[model samples]
Target: MPNMGRKLRVGMVGGGGPANFFGGPHRRGILIDNSAELTAGALRSNPDDAIASARDLFFTRGYGDWRSMIAEEAKRDDGIDYVTIVTPNDAHFGPAVAAAEAGMGVLCEKPLVMNLDEARTLHQAVKTAGVPFVVAYTYTAFPMVMMARHMVADGKVGEVRKVEAWYPQGWLAGSRESTADAAGQKQASWRVDPSKSGASGCGGDIGTHAYEFVRFVAGLTATRVRARLKTFVPGRALDDDFTVLADLDNGGVATIAASQVTIGAQNDNGFRVVGTEGTLEWSITDHNNLKYYRAGEPVHVYRLGGMYNYFPSTITPFIRVPEGHPEGFHEAMANLHRCLEWQIRAKLGEQVPDHMHLPGIADGVAGMAFLDAAVRSGRQDGEWVDVEPVG
Candidate 1:
């Protein structure tokens, strides 16, 4: 079949209205390049909302059942070539496993699944199916983030020693307000529900991002974790605040925190990696700049721009606009999308870029392992627990 000169067809799952969770970002990211088509979707759990969401995004006929969407799309002559899972944390496993089993490319939201067991199953399925798979660790997609990764790899931060990383939000500061109510928008309602979001709330939701950032920038693999998890809200089933101390594979140390109950800490996410020679820091608070400090040298600021002319050549294509123009969340997602686009093409026997930087199945499995270890450590009153090795 001649599939040249055509955008890859996509089916999206669970990016519905009144809920701007991963679904929205995933859709926007996939469509940002105009190199992919959103031809089908199972946009919501409610049939009416699903229809409305699909029509709003101009996706053809939304289906309430994600499995139905996948099955029907598979049988079509011009069915979706791949599927993106943008549902809640607990909802990712089924769609992703089904997609892989059906031999379709799959892109999934992070904390890959609810637990380590699911992570292992999904990882195995995707590997055995020989399908392209990715876990959406969107922060690493940022240009400066990639630059930081490049710098660490090139020995800019000499011999990683210690790392501090966190993602904290005050939206859930109070015991009374829901995320949707607090944000006045489509926020994660199921985040505080254990059944929906799994054991650890804030950690699974955003702590993985922090841990992933540390790994991405510091070039360290976590080997073990000692953690304390807390639930501040009166009736919440999951931990909304967590602090973890981790040992990295390279003999480095990390202090990680992710909390939704922190007062006045809206989306304060970032990391600082300290090595034998220096330290590097970046955060969403200063979304466009990265802080670099070497022991004897003055602190330096790096921005998202072409004119700055200090970054590596690999950083160029990720720059979306001029110097003064800032690139933030959407661009990061789009960057991953662009990489995945070429990745999908590579599977189709077309030559594209080499060594894609997007987080893959192993990363996802590792993330889940980190979560499992943290929870275990917390249960034992901050006892150090080894992160399970995955092959």
Candidate 2:
């Protein structure tokens, strides 16, 4: 807490070299609160790329490997208060576990690891280290999404009967020059590789985002699922399209789906929760708005601002701008980072609210369970698979 008035010093792991898809959003988002600084980075596997990224990001210096960076940074009096892991799936385990064991706070990209066991081990380490940790499940931090959660808890949607969620993108639609990615040329090339991305591709990537959205909004757990996963692209090692039917803990049901091969869909992530009284809808494409429907009333659209009479008062504090102007993905992520930063400050003896929380290790573990069960059910031809929640 010696640097209480200063920004939290942040060290980095891997993202991408030239420019990463994840790192930009994360850094932009965390800075939205002006709570953290990107003082150091180990941006890529190649030492040259890492150094180049450090220069581009204006870091104090770049190291060749995360272990070297972590160890050296730990020796500083103003050493990184936290580390951000933006590496790919296979690369997450070593650095994250090592950082937590080293007593540095960790905020990692999702899905937290390639497997649930890794998640459990990381969880244990964080607990023992007593450091704050979070997985970047960014969508849950959206203002409207939180409003949806507030509404569900308020029974604005009544008794939740069913939920439907899907994240469809057209990014992986066509054939790739197989050699281009192996030579480390383009973005997301590792996503289709089983060894690099994990067991299921589409479901593990965006599908888990949809799954988290459903649970976050509906405030219910899907204990089991019946799923089908498919790979449309030729010579692919994992799935690109997946659909799942889940049985909720409250006896409700959900249809969850995600696809990277949907032509023209373009990151269309959305969900609808149907309750006995009404239904709630939200889409990240139209992120600022949350639509609501009641049995005997007109549709109510709540924008992400205080001027809206329809929006609950709880949402006002999170609204950063005027009514018509929209808050976006960066803002959503910023909110999550803000919450996490507050928790870090609280840990450092600065007073902060107790109910402040974001998806942590248990949620990360549960996400792995979701992906694992989907793969298992897909293999067994749409059989039911149970999801035991974990961080």
Candidate 3:
């Protein structure tokens, strides 16, 4: 059970549309286990939309703007302990900065901000405010992924030699000749627009996830990268596909790719880590199962919720059921929310479980740096580009 001694008072920014489109999962996840409650929210960019969203979500206090939410909440003795930023890539910076300045912990959506400069500024702001900040990297919270991290960290896989990670989607594979003005088209609009989604579209949207996941599981950073980027869709403003060869800090190499134009493929995000001793492989489709290989031994498949002494103890709390009861994407997202809630409680001087520590601002910054460098490298004709190390 989550610690009920105190509920982390929470406020949300951007709940107007699909919460997942903004920051809904974080709010729902925190509230799920009774560890946190949604006290207030400035849910939309527009005043009417914000109020409507708040009422729909049943928030007690609703404000049209995030500034008002922060200001009003700060004056109360029982003010919100944390604020969640779920706005668009361009909109993430303002609310997050405001929340931090108001002395609130934050859990913002990934890609941190629209660009590297904004990411750096937000990082500095959070540090100056001295509050816990988390970036919503939903994949890292998966039980099996956590197990993989543990295995790699414990030398279960020995020294890492190579890694491969990719996220491919077929949603945008339509013929470009069929449509004009892809900008205003629902799915490809904001994403393909450089101004809204940043310099690279698919790279920033899902490629960053691939980069962060591999790094998290293997516990390494890319020192250099060589890449290619493409816009398969005709008349598209940004690259819809990206591929990269990364040089890892630990003398290992990684191949990373993300594409929105893979026809018939649906959410094919997966990774395989190879080491001197053995290998570990997993995919988003078969998220509950992780394959473990040891030289001269039959491969072992570990399933989530399975009773295995070899499983990492760090993931025990996240396992809610016995093995073979499938727990997939949404559950993984919930785990991140659970961790964020615990971290928020710890900040308020309340007891939090040991597994509360998840990827935070630093991880988000690293993801942004990866995107920035990858795009730059791709533009330079796959030249070896030194990735700016993010702390």
TM-score of each: 0.93, 0.93, 0.93
Ranking by lDDT: 1, 2, 3
- Tens-digit lDDT track of model 3 for 326-378: 87666676677677666666766777556735788888888888888888998
Q: On a 0 to 100 scale, what is the lDDT of residue 267 in model 3?
A: 81
RMSD of each: 2.7, 2.6, 2.5
RMSD of 3: 2.5
Q: For model 1, where is the 10-residue window of minimal lDDT?
A: 177-186
* Candidate 1 lDDT over residue span 1-391, tens digit each: 1234578888888877664566777778888877888888888888877877898888965787788888988888888878888877888999999988888888888878999999999999999998888778898888888878887888888999999999998877775435436444235457777777887888899899999987778777789999999988787788889899999998889999998888889889888988877788988878888889987789988888877778776677677788989888898888877776677788888766444367888889988889999999999999989999987
Error of 3 at 89 (Å): 0.6
lDDT of 3 at 109: 79
The C-alpha lDDT values of all candidates are 0.82, 0.82, 0.81
Q: In candidate 2, which residue ranges exceed 4 Å CA deviation?
A: 1-4, 177-185, 306-317, 353-356, 389-391
lDDT at position 124, candidate 3: 92
